[model samples]
Target: MRISSEEELSGVVRDATGPLCIRGGGTRDIGRPAPGAVIDVSGIAGIRIYEPGALTLVAGAGTPLAEVEAALAAEGQRLAFEPADWRGLLGTEGVPTLGGMVASNASGPRRVQAGACRDALLGVRFVDGAGAIVKNGGRVMKNVTGYDLARLLAGSWGTLGIMTEVSLKVLPAPEAAATLVMTGLDDAQALRAMTAALQSPFDVSGAAHGDIGTLIRVEGFSQSVAYRSGKLAQMLAPFGAVTVERDGESVAALWRDVRDLAPFRGTPGDVWRFSVKPSDAPALVDGLRRAGPVERVLYDWGGGLVWVETAPGRDLRPERLEGHATLMRASTETRARIAPFQPESAPVAAIAAGLRARFDPRGILNPGRMG
Candidate 1:
């Protein structure tokens, strides 16, 4: 259904009895199959409101992320919770939508400090499967209620309902930032270094590691960033020789590539996203190495987030990954044959099912996208 207006969208949903899938920018269009008509929410796109002082920004579901970022940049503020650029990994072109980012709960290296998308979401307005326009939470922080359903729907992969507008918490941009690059540490050593820095008194905003290098980022006032950089460098000294700083342009380029997963782009391989205990990352990477030829592995969120690209034609099975592994980018055959999500416990599965039923009774919204 082409919903040009929010009211019209709600009307269409209210009349539906079977199932309905919500479609936005279609970046993750292939992630799931729609069993019924798709409610193309992209048609209802625009920024409804933005208040810098209030640290709140609300936009239509289809508002492109690029536009939102540009606006926030002009105001010297930004979404405190960094979102990822999935287009690079998917090998697709087009700006991702704000709603899609919230739906996927996508985050970048900054997640280690700034937190995830769900954490920054203040409120949400969406159309449920019953075609009712429901508002949850609020524009301000601190909402006490029976359940925080807004967050519950944030990462539901459009399986729950159609998010029409979202109010997110924003923060002023950091005064300055710097990256400390340490070269030549294996996965295990890198993970240890990152974990240590995360636990330190210095406020390390971002930490990421790849096959060739490990990076630690400090963001704050110029003097503070400088002081923390020196302290973090000393702390990471045990790992190996380290490079103190990266120029602004170079730092921006590096993080852009990091957010885009540049090293894995255009590579003919299976990509997996794993979330495990920070301490478990080393063991998982080592297990992957023993299993087969792994091309590139990027660790983020202080080793909690693992992005791995397997060798061409090699089976990147969860069983071989040794820890929790979710296939984030994969071929159709691979996705169909393997589970894309970590196996949930029975109680968690039951809770997920109940939440699904509450927002999407007919299982029409991007069914199986998360599973």
Candidate 2:
């Protein structure tokens, strides 16, 4: 089934007798496979409003992300959260949509500084399972008294509601950007260096460690980028000689690779993602190896986000880690046997169940995707 407008979507929900699997661009295929009739929302697309001066944009949820980015680029602005393109990682083929990005909360490396997709989200329009069209938030930022549905739905993965439209806060594109690279440092040393750089006053925009090397990103006016990148090199001297990539093309390509997990593309293993304390990253990587063979490890967001490629179908959750590990890629049988998302505690799970009951009383939207 396909819906082209808000009214059509609401009608479809009202008529659905069984589960409905919500699909956008089909780029992010995480979690357990949802069993239902596919409701394609790509028809509900187009930019509705864009105020470049105000740094805000409003668009239909199904609008192609590439179109939105092109519009933003023309005005010298961009999504502050730096959302990643997951097609390569998921091996799915389709243009990413704004709604899909919001549903999955597909944030990139810039999240360490700007925040997640939810932070950039100012408002949303969606349809609850009851066939009611609900709107929360607005184009501008302000405090609201009650449940912030805009945020609550951002990363809900379409279980509670189907988003129809979204409004986001944007940022001016940096006049210049550069990455400081350091080689020969192990994960521990890389984490220490990245932590120091992030904690410093240099306003580093990106920090990551992987097979390539340890990288620190700074962006601003040309002079500012030069000064900060040079200073970062000096500060990181103890780790290794830091090479600054000042050419814009090189800097962009490198960060895009990090943002998209380019290194993991086309690899032959199930993928896992972990969210742990920046300091705990190295230990967690070590623990993952002890549990089973891990093909590759990439650290991003100052080590707060860890991506792992390991043997297919092995449960790689570290026994005593402070954070959670999510299975990002696996066979259907493996996903059915192992929970993809972190198992929530009693209280949190109760709250989630209550929210779902309130929004999707019939339990017909994307059933079992989260589990």
Candidate 3:
């Protein structure tokens, strides 16, 4: 059902009295199956308010991310915690909504320093499964009165409720930024170099390494960026074969592709996102490599986030890999045959069920989307 107004949405959800699948732009339709009627929230679009000095912006749930970026750009500000642009990687259009991104807790390379979508989210207004409008958090930064319900819904993937509006913390545009590109290092060496750069006081905002090259970004004053780039290069000299590309546009373009996973686009294979200790990345990748051919692997957060694309018919079970691996993106057949997420422990599973009950007692919101 296409809900144009908030009231209409609430009424439909109340009347259904069953599970509802929240859809915005429908870019990630493949990741999770919708077992109920789809409630398209894109109709509820547009920004409500933006305050530059306060570094705050509020918009309806269906507000397009492109629109939000453009609006923030006009005010010389931006979403400090960069959200991932999955369109390029998924071979879909860049039409994701701010609510979708927040709900997914999507983040890019900047997440190493800037944090995730939950960190930038200040407030949210959503309708519960009971059709009651609930508001959590506030426009200001220091709202600690209630149980941070806003953040709870941030990465819930609409399984809890349907978000109506969101308020986010914005940041001023960086004065200057540059990326240091280091080439020809193996996964272990690249991760070491990235970790070394992150340890420095120069403040590397982004660190990502693909199979062929590693990219480090420093954002601040032009002089500071230049100085840090040089220092980072020196620190990584032991890793062998280093190249620094200092152009701002080029750096941005490179990271944009990284954030979007451009290299793995349109590949006929399954994509998985593995989260493990940064030091364990090499072993995990190597183990997976032994299992089958890996099309591409992008390491983020100094190896904490590993995006692995496997050849067709390759089974990537967490039990098979040395460390845990979760299937972030997959085809319908693959999803049916293999578990998308790693099996949670009994305690964690109980807690997750409790949380789900609190938000959606009737199990009327995106049932089994995360499972």
Candidate 4:
């Protein structure tokens, strides 16, 4: 079923009897099968408001991400978190939607300096399991109140409820950007450089390392970017071959390549996303290497996020790491045999169950997709 407005969508949801798989653009539906009628919200799309001066945008949940990006580009602004489009990596033809990114809390290379999709989200309008329309937050960027349901729902997929609309804080487009590549450094050394740059006052906006090379990004006025890029290069010179990419266009594409996990795309293996301490990255990679082969490892978020492409059906879950790992891409058989999301501890599991029960009493929304 498809809905063009919240009222129409809410009514259908009120009458739905079986499991409901909420869909938007369908580019990110690679999880375990969500059995039941499909509720496609792509029809409920368009910008409601865009206050360039205020750096805020309110839009329907189903609005295409490309559309929102174009609108922001016209005003010399963009989504501060630098959301990544997963179509190429997921191998799905469907376009990405802003709502889908919010549901997944998608964050790219810039996440280290800016934030995640959840942090930029300011307000949302959604429907409850009982068919009641609920709203939280507003257009303001700051909210220090009671329960933060808006945030709670940001990464909840559609299991919590159907998101009909969202308000996000936007940011001005950087006047210039540069990326410095340091080659030949092993994983540990690359991570050290990333850590050093992120920790310093270089205002580094992006940081990542993989089998190819380590990258450090800076953005701001052309002069400021050049100065910082040079200073950072000097600081990182001890780490091996260093090359500066001062062309804004080329640097943007380079980050996108890293952001989309381009190196691992079309490869024959299962992909995993790991969130660990920046310092723990090398150790975690070493631990995983002990188990067969890790075809590719892409580190982002100053090494906090590690994307791994392992041999098919191989388990790369660190034995005692303080972070979680998700099976980002795998066949249905493989996914069904192994856990998709990280298993929450007993206390955390109980809290999640309570929230799920409270929001979806019938357990009819994306049943078992998260487990």
Best by TM-score: 2
List the candidate numbers ranked by TM-score, top first.
2, 4, 3, 1
Tens-place lDDT per residue, model 3, 180-220, is 88888889888888888898898999888995489888998
Residue 352 alpha-carbon offset, candidate 3, angstroms: 1.2
Per residue, candidate 1 scores C-alpha lDDT tens digits across 320-361 of: 444566677777666666667777779989998998888778
On a 0 to 100 scale, what is the lDDT of residue 60 in model 3?
92
CA shift of 196, model 3, Å: 0.7
Model 1 lDDT, full chain set:
0.81
Q: Per-prediction TM-score, please?
A: 0.93, 0.99, 0.96, 0.98
Off by over 4 Å in 1: 17-19, 29-32, 311-323
Tens digit of per-residue lDDT, candidate 2, span 16-119: 89999999998888888999999999999999999998889999999999999999999999998899998788788999999999998989999999999999
Worst window of 10 by summed lDDT in candidate 2: 139-148
Candidate with the larger lDDT of 2 and 3:
2
Best-to-worst order by lDDT is 2, 4, 3, 1
Q: What TM-score should be assigned to candidate 3? A: 0.96
Tell me how far candidate 2 lies from the true structure as C-alpha RMSD in angstroms.
0.9
Error of 4 at 128 (Å): 1.7
